[model samples]
Every structure is written in C-alpha cells, then in structure tokens.
Target: MLSTKVAADTTPSTRNYDDNVAVDTKKKVDRARGNITQRRCLIDNIWNAHVVDYAHVYEADGKKDGLISKLERSWNVKSGTLNSNTRRNIFRLSAKLHRLFDEEKWLLLPETKIVDQYYEHYREAGYADEFPVIKDLSFNYTLVAHPDMRQVAIHRRVEGVDINTPGAFKTFIYPFDTFPVIVSHVHPCFVICNSGQKLKDYDKIVAFRKGDTDQRKKRIARIQSFSKRLDGW
Candidate 1:
C-alpha cells in the first residue's frame, strides 16, 4: 500500500494557474528581459553607446499652417549621460554580438546549420547583443547615473593565449568572473580579446563629429546664418 501510495503521489498531473494577474505579470516580465535602450553610433561596425542623454522629444504647437504642418514626424536620439555598470552591459552585449559573428564566420558551418548554430554558438561564446529577451532581464538602468561617461569595451586579446572559460572570446568583455579564462576566447576569436575601457569624459569623448577647433567655428557660422534668417523674416 505504501509503495502504491508513493507511486500515486509521484505521478504528475497537468495543473494550470487561474489567477489572471499572476499570468499577466509573468508575461510582462518575460517580455522586458533585455531591452537596454541607449543611443549609439557605429564605430567600425562596433557600437559605441554613450550613456549620457542629450535628447528631448520635441512637440509641435497647434494651429500650424498647412505647408509647415505637413512635415511628417521628426525625432532625434540625443546623447545622454551613463553609468559604469550600464556601460559595461551595453558594451558587453555589442562585443558578444561581434564575437559571435566572428566565430560563425570561422566555423564556416553549412548554411543549413547557421540558424541552429547561431544561438548555440552565442551561448557558448557570450551574449553581447544586449537585446533584452524578457521583462525579468530588464535592469531599468538609465543614463547620467550609469557609466557617467567614458566606459567602453575593448576586445584585443594577447597572442598565443588559449581561452578555456570563454574569457576574451570577443572584444567587449568585463570581469564576467564566472566563466573560466580558457572558455572565454573560444576558438576563432581566440586572440584572448583584450579590452581597454575609459569612462566618458566630455573632453575625452570627442563625441561631436566635428573636431574641437572646427566645431567651434562651425557653431559660430551656424548661429550667424540662423540670425540672418530670423532678421529677414
């Protein structure tokens, strides 16, 4: 009888949750997993995300004329401030993505296997994509408090070093202290990806596309042009 009772207890039955709120919460959590939002520019196809924000979502006034009002939606991704950990996550994701691409290229897997192999290799290598898979993964970090300015991911690794912990497998890496060093660099990108990170300092960033001296001159010229236009109006 005990044996029979144990067997019955061990048998599993399909059970479902009835609470709608609980279900919805779980779903929402699932959705916001990895959505780290930051404005960035592609430097050498590697993204440089400056966590500092300088953007304002613009709005238009009512009673605009037809021609001017006809202008479609306009927006801008302004630069903003950032903190250290957030910068770490952002650069880490980017570097991992690039690293995966490199590994994939080296693997030369048949096209048929690319899809299956892509993610597997990504896990084995690292997740630098920074794309949040669900709500649970959402860290909700913002600029100004995070990375504050000059953090970056560097992937240049040492020569002849074999990675066993997925260590410097790709360029963008940090303490990821969990993985073994041998596993870090993987195989193809096994150069023990070296990274040098400097925090974002306004003077250091050179974020402005125009060089320093040139930028000042350009700004003066632009103001002059705008002033003349306003005067004509």
Candidate 2:
C-alpha cells in the first residue's frame, strides 16, 4: 500500500506535590487537592474519551482519515495548516501503521539511531539557556517496518533495482501521538515509514508508561536488539 516495496514492509507504529501551614490550612489544602484531583480526572477523561472515539471510528469505518482527524482535533491541530498533499500523506501513513498493527510487523526503532548527541554537545557549550529542555526526546520511538538487506537483495533480483539504495525511497517521520488503546501507555512515539511514491512530500519529519521509566528501558532494549541485527553486527 505504501507504493514502495521497502516501506510496504516497514512502518507502523507527570506529577507534583507540596505542603504548607495556614489559617484554613486543612480546608484549603483539601480544596486545593480536590481541585487538583478534578483537573487530573478531567484531563484523563478528555484523552481517554478521544481514545475511545478513535477505536470506534477505526472499527466502524476502518479508515485512517477518520482516526487521524480525531487525533489532530484532540491536539488542536488544524488540518488547514498543512497543504492537501501533506495531509494525504499523513493519512496514508496512519493507514499503513494500522495495517502493520494487524500484521504484527511493527519494528521498534532504537534511540541510538536518531539520538541527537549534538544536542547535548550544544547544550554543554553554554547553549542550555537558549533552548527548551525536552527530557522526553529520548523516549520517542521511531518504529519502521523496513525489510532486511537480505530481503532487499531478493527484491533486487526480481525488480532489477535495489529500493534500499539511497534516495530510492523517501522516509517520512511523523510525531504521531495516540495510537488507539491497543498500544497501551499511549505515550508519544515517532513513526518512520517510507512512501516511495513521493519524494517532495515536505510534510517535515517528526511513548509509554510504567511510570514511563521502565517502559522506556524495555523499548530501548528491544530496539537495540533489532538494531543489532539490522546493522549485521
């Protein structure tokens, strides 16, 4: 469905506290705690409600456009902000991920592959104040459904050209959030899929829980394993 043979194979995919003393100390604290609890519930309600809606849409129509629209709406992402073709490409990507989900072909991308080491280098060079620190940058996953080189070799034998060659395939990395309820944790993760169909798609590039710490470690391990084999190490 991705038009590109290789892409057809790959792609898919806080708290606080305080204490104090005062006149209405107990009452105020309780009220404040109540407000905080209510806010948390409200936030979860909004997010989970959309998750349910996404599942419903995917089930009812089995279409990615509907799901993508819901995701965009939840984030206040205006479809108008992107050109028609860019939007279409995103829709296609969402569709491809869903298909990969069905096929159980989602590949976990390792952070080492995309980690911006230079980001830290720059920060250490007295640029820390110049940029916002995004601690979650390392938590993002860049899942891809890429075929192995061996598979590509076979493909080359048949197609007479190696799709894996540089520039032969166009990779699209999307900062996709909310992958329905199936992907437990619902944390933000990147999705890398190629649609060799288009090379000019300007739609520029681009989760978990368990307190998010343990989840991240597990993902990193899995991705590292995949990366090893991918690199033929």
Candidate 3:
C-alpha cells in the first residue's frame, strides 16, 4: 500500500540519467545501420541501441515548441493526444531542460532507488526467527557539472524497505556508462548482476550477443595468434 501526501508534495519526480563525467564519454564501438533505432523531433535527435547488454536503448525529444509549454504544464501520458512514449521522452529531456531553468544546480538530480534482503543463518545457533536482513536505499545522482548537469530519478520496489528506519540496510546506486543501476552488496569473485551492479573495484562488461556466435568464435583466432606470437618469442 502506497500513499501520496499531496499537501507536502514539493518535488516533481521523474527518470534522470546519471552519467557524471560532465559529458557523454561513452561511445558505441561497433554500430550497425539497419538494427539501429533513431528517434527524431524538432529540438532533439537521439540514437538508441541497435544492440545492448550492459546498457539500454536511449531516447530524447528535440522539439523546441515544447520548451515553453513544458515549464508551465505537467505533460505526461493520459493527457489526451500525447501517447505514453512522448511523455517518457519529455522525462529524458528534462535533465537538460531543468538545468537551463535552474541555472545549473548539480545536486537537484535524483538517482534510482533499490532495496535488498540479506539473511544470515541462525539455525547454527539454534534460533528460529530471522533477524534484520533487509536494506532500503536510494542514491541521488548529479552530473559532474556540464552539458546542463544531467538529472535522473527512479524507484524500485524493494521487498522490505521502511523509510521510517534510516541506515538499516545497505544500498548502492551509481551511473554505469550513463545508465543508473542499483544493487546491494559487492561480490569480488562472484558474478555481478547483469542488471548493472558495478561493484567496487569492478571492470567494464562488454556487450555481446550469442546470436552472433560466429563473431565471438572469430575472436578466438586473435587469441590463438597471440599465443603463437608468444611461442615464437
């Protein structure tokens, strides 16, 4: 059961991307023409994903006419003619738009929220009831301060999170290649969640498709060649 207190509501919440290097540094390494998805309008044009694994397809709206109307109106799906997709488009563009309106405040951004439940075995100690094992958390994301200080917000329904109790659970939320992923606990040797949990001391995950089995198989040639070179040395 969720409740919204209309009287104390002071903020408009929406999705905000959390790429914080101050600009878009991530690039598509092997972009294809046919599989690509490009969304265009008057004010913005964005190239979404033809293929993605660690990342997702991006979106935007470059239409200039909506700017004036956006500041004054709460434009979203279910208004009338505008579809749900357009409402979503506005949310993505909000980062750049809000930056312009606020004169660039980095802290105004909100990151995705995630919750986790971690349990320890009490059976060894002969206990029947479970102890504290759930964590509730939300991280606020801010761009490093360029390209209009990108802002994004997302909330995930964690199993057992009570806003009333602070610091009962551990949470992590960070921007991974511009997309925000929230996860709990860092596993060094274990596989990280494919959903985008960048653990501390983590390395980048390459996007690949098993459907392109031949492409991946071809990479083995490079590895074999390198081994031959080592043998020659």
Candidate 4:
C-alpha cells in the first residue's frame, strides 16, 4: 500500500512540462496501442509528465533502511487481496496516482487526514490482526514534507525475495514511476480500496486465461519497446 502527504513549501519556483513532450509521449502511446495494455498507457503518461524523485525503504539484514525505515516492516492485505498480480497492480496504481497528483500539484491537506482516519478506523474496527504488523505500525508524521525537498515515494522491499513467488517479501509492494510539480489545494481526484479482494485461489483460476509462454513473451517485448520509446521523450 502507498500514500502521499503534501505540505506547503517556501520555494517559489514551479516545474512545467513542454507541450512537445506531451505530444511526443502521445505519439509513442498511439504506436503501442496495438500491443500494450491500458495499464501500460497509464504508466507512459505518468513517466513523461514531469520529473519525479523516488525513495525506497525496506529491511536489509534485519535493519530498516530508506526514508520510512522507522516504520514497521510487515504489511497485511485485506483478507482476499493476496493474489500476486492483483496486489502488484494495486501497488502500481497507487504509486502512479501519487505521481500524477504531485505533477499537477492537486494535493489537498484534507487528503492526508483522510488517509489517517482510514488507518484509525481500520484499527478501531479490530482489523489490526488482519495485518500482523499493525500492532506496531506507526507512521512518522514528520516524514511528510514539501515535495520539492524530497518528493516522497516509498516501496517496502524484502531482500533476497523472488517477486514471482507467493508470500515473498518483494510481493508485499512493487515499485512505481512518478513525476514532479508544485503543491496546491485540490479536491480528492481518486479513491483507493474500492476494489475487493479475492476469496478463492486467484492464480489457479486465472492463470489458464492469461495465455501461453509465447504470448507472454510478446507482451513483455511490447512493454519494453514502449519503455524505450518513452526514454527518448
């Protein structure tokens, strides 16, 4: 899971993107539309939109590291959202939205309060046990700072873990792309957690429909091509 906290800064400068950059990014998107997924398109838009700075915090040899190292190491998913692909997508979308909002400076102080209330409600409802780490889960409110200084982006990585394997540490959260912009008040543009978790074995039921190895390879190739095109933009 991911969240962004936006605060006012004393800096007077603002970042802007060139019109040509957006035009070129759209061209790349159009070229890849025949072969890529909507998710990939969303990623492309986020990447070319602005300059983003990222920071990661995770456990290394039993020690915490990154901007959020002091926070708890364990994370819990809602009872049913544990499927590898589903979880991965949630992480990706959350990071993407964070970057998009940052780029536009459409961040509201109330949004941070809403995120805080969410966790408080979860704990008061006796859902802490659902995520074992919640008992010790404490957020460093001081970590929330002006985006210009440290554009906060966090992902909890488990060292030596294979992301493809179920229950692996890396599977807890995935890294995502971002862009930069100034901070300003805006109404909430998106909401998280509307999607429900799976109650059954997601992999066993969905794997068959995903296609064969050759098809998978082609999809990967297309994504790589799209990424390369964006690099040029």
Candidate 5:
C-alpha cells in the first residue's frame, strides 16, 4: 500500500507546481541546445557579408581589399586598434570555417603557413615587442595590453634562463603563455573569393539579413514574448 501510494504521488498528473515548472524548464533547456547552430549563424552572417563586399570591390575596379582594411572601412575603427585577442579569434574562426567549407585562398599567406612560419617567429622571440608589425604578417601580432600580458604570465612557469637574458620582455613572455597567436596573412593585393553570391544562399542566413523590417519585427516579437515571462522567473 505504501509503495502504491508513493507511485501515485510521483505521477506527472499528481506532481506539485514546482515540479511542473522544473519539468517545463528542463524541456525548454533541452530544446534550446542549438547554441552551436546559433553561433555558426552569427559568424556566418559576418563572414558572408564580408565576402560579398570583397567580391563587389573586386568586380568594381579589380581591387582586392585586405580583410582588416575591409573591416576597418565597415566598422570605422582606426588601424592598429584591434587587440591581440580579437585578431586571434578572427583568424582561428576563419581558418576553421575555411577548412570546413573548403574556402579558396582569400589570404595571400595561407592560414596554415602563417601559423607555422610567421606566428612561430614572434612567439619564439620571447617578447611582446618581438612580434612583427609587417604588412604581410599583420595577422601575426597586435599590441597586447600590459595587464593582460602580466595576467597570462602569472601561471606560466618561468625559468632562470628566461628571466636573466632579457629586458622587460621576460616579464611578459613565459614558457606556457600562448598570448593569442594569429592565423593568416591578408596581403594587400591578394585575390578575393568570388563566392559571395553563393555564400548568401549557402546557409539560408540571407533570410535574417540586416535591413529586413518585417523579419526584424518578428524577431522583436519573439524576444518580447519570452521577456514577459521574466517576471515569473
């Protein structure tokens, strides 16, 4: 009789209000597990737009825009303002996507070659300023903030030789700190990929492209729909 009573109380129909909310939340969480798809969509939006712009510039005057120059043009950021972290993420993501999608050589120095050759040169130099500032190696280095460099060096295992042989550079470079390496070199005159039109339809992301008033309204409505539930949460 006790076991029967326990089973009856534990049934979904007889579960308490908190249990119902918990079950509902769990179901929603489970269904919301497409974060990777969402992130890919986000990155693809930026990438496809850039590729389209690249193709347009190329077709207009036979001029291929450097990736960073294109970004600076679009974003209105000053040159050399991009930190090492942002540059690193862009390089890694672009390289990964290129591998996955078989993107043609947009960069003058291929991503693998840049990582292997130019990036290794600065990293092994054992100093922040030792990172190159050349045009072809733009992807390899950036101005790292002193605080960030110090924080990274904290966990790094320092050697007596590393400390004794250098200036303040040793205070920054340590054995374990990767310090945000870069990927590909974007040459000034490199050829642009001509797949911008194809990339527009590649991921069906064009449906969510910027400047669609109706789609934007629908997205806002979806957000507001859940935002109303925040009070309950």
Candidate 6:
C-alpha cells in the first residue's frame, strides 16, 4: 500500500505548487539558452561581414613583386642614385597612395585569426608592413581649472597610446598643416579629417589635410581661387 501511495503522489495531476514552479523554471531556462545561441550566430555574421585579405590580392597579381621593389628603391635612394628632391617626391607619392587607400575605405577589418598578426606587423614594422585595417582616428584634449587664480591647465592624449602615466606627459603640438608628418611617425595608413569639427567646435582644424607642405599650399591656392571665382559671379 505504501508503494501504491508513492506512485500516486508522483503523478503530475497530484503534484503541488512547487512542482509547477519547477516546470516553469525549466522552460525559462530553455528559452534563455535558445536566445543565447541565436545571439552568438548573429554576432558571428556581423564580425565577418567585410573580411579583406590584402596580402592575398598582392600575391595573386603577377607584377606586384616588381612594383613593390620599385617603390622600395625609391624610398631608399642613396645620395647619388636619385636627387634629394626626386626622392622626396617619390616618398610623398607613396604616402599619398597609402592615405588614399585608408581614406577611401579600401582596407577592411581582417578575420579574428589574422587580426593580431596584422597588428603585430604594423606595430613592429611601421607603415612598410602588410596593409593594416584602417579605422577612424581622433584625439582627446581635456581642460581643467587650476587652484591658482590666474592659470588654467591643459592635457592631451592621442588615440592609440595608453592613458595611465606616472609623471607629466609631454605632447607635441604642430600646426594643422603638419598633421600628416606627426601621424607618419605612428603609421602611414591614417588620414586626419575634420569630421569632429562640428561636434567638438574645433575651429583650427577647419582646413587640415593629410599631406606635405606642397600639398597644403596647393589646397590653399585652390580654395582662394574658388573664393575669387565666387566673388566675380
């Protein structure tokens, strides 16, 4: 009789409130599990939506090797091989091509397996490494009031560098036209634009461009010519 009573108590129709709660909890757990699986699938698709392999393209092209060799020669020209001005022109042209690739969004973020590889390449080898994935770059400048009556304080931080430092951090400030030279020290695959001008109210950066002195002069000339033409109209 005890065995029969135990079987009757174990049946669903004879269950208590605790048993109903347990069943509802199990259903919620199953739904949460399903949601997590679906989210992972969606994230995977987004992460790999635009994977580009630049090295593979360069390898597939038959003349890539010769072209790279020529550029390197131009970059490393000795005192007698090419005049200093000519060498500078070559360097500028090469830099312009790199800046164009970055500005035009030709390079896309690589896959996870190779992303670290490209980062290491850029960090160690500078701009001459395999083409790096380009992303928007910006700087942060913070201003705070000093305890003294007459003075204010300014602090600056570049986009990629670390924030934590023990002592006074030195920052290099250059004219807007020299921005490209400043960035070339970090990497050639970057361009400075005024996208943040309206957001930050950065008046000085209104005419900044990623080019050398000559390029900056040409840009100024074009702007002046346009202004004059408009006035004549």
Clashes of each: 54, 5, 7, 1, 0, 0
Prediction 4 global C-alpha lDDT: 0.25
> Which lDDT tens digits does candidate 2 get at residues 62-168?
23334334334333445423111120122111322334433433333334423344224333642222322223312333333332211221100112335465634
Give the clashing pairs for model 4. 80-198
The C-alpha stretches of model 6 lying farther than 4 A from their native spots are 1-156, 166-170, 174-212
**lDDT, residue 233, model 1:** 30
Worst 10 residues of 2 by lDDT: 1-10
- What does candidate 5's lDDT look like per residue over 1-233, in tens digits? 00011011222123232221233322332233222222121112222322211111111111212433443333344654422112112121222333322222111112334233333543364222333333443333211121212233321123233434443132334222233332232221121122231123323223222232453334323322222322222
Question: Which lDDT value does model 5 have at 35?
Answer: 22
What C-alpha root-mean-square deviation, in Å, does candidate 4 show against the real structure? 21.6
Better of 3 and 4 by TM-score: 4
lDDT of 6: 0.24
- Model 4 poorest 10 in a row by lDDT: 190-199
Tens-place lDDT per residue, model 6, 158-178, is 333454653333332322221
Per-residue alpha-carbon lDDT of model 1 for 28-131, expressed as tens digits? 32232242232221111222433221110111112222211222111011112111111112222243333322222111111112222333433453422331
Error of 6 at 164 (Å): 2.8
Candidate 3 regions with alpha-carbon error over 4 angstroms? 1-57, 60-158, 167-169, 173-233
The TM-score values for the models, in the order shown, are 0.16, 0.21, 0.16, 0.20, 0.17, 0.20
For model 1 the TM-score comes to 0.16
Which has the higher TM-score value, candidate number 3 or candidate number 6? 6
RMSD of each: 22.4, 22.4, 22.5, 21.6, 25.5, 26.4
lDDT for each of the candidates? 0.22, 0.25, 0.22, 0.25, 0.26, 0.24
Error of 1 at 91 (Å): 20
Candidate that scores best on lDDT: 5
Estimate the TM-score for candidate 5: 0.17
lDDT of 3 by residue, 90-163 (tens): 12223343333223222111121111111112223222134222222222222222222224332222335664
In angstroms, the error of model 5 at 3 is 65
Q: Which candidate has the top score in TM-score?
A: 2
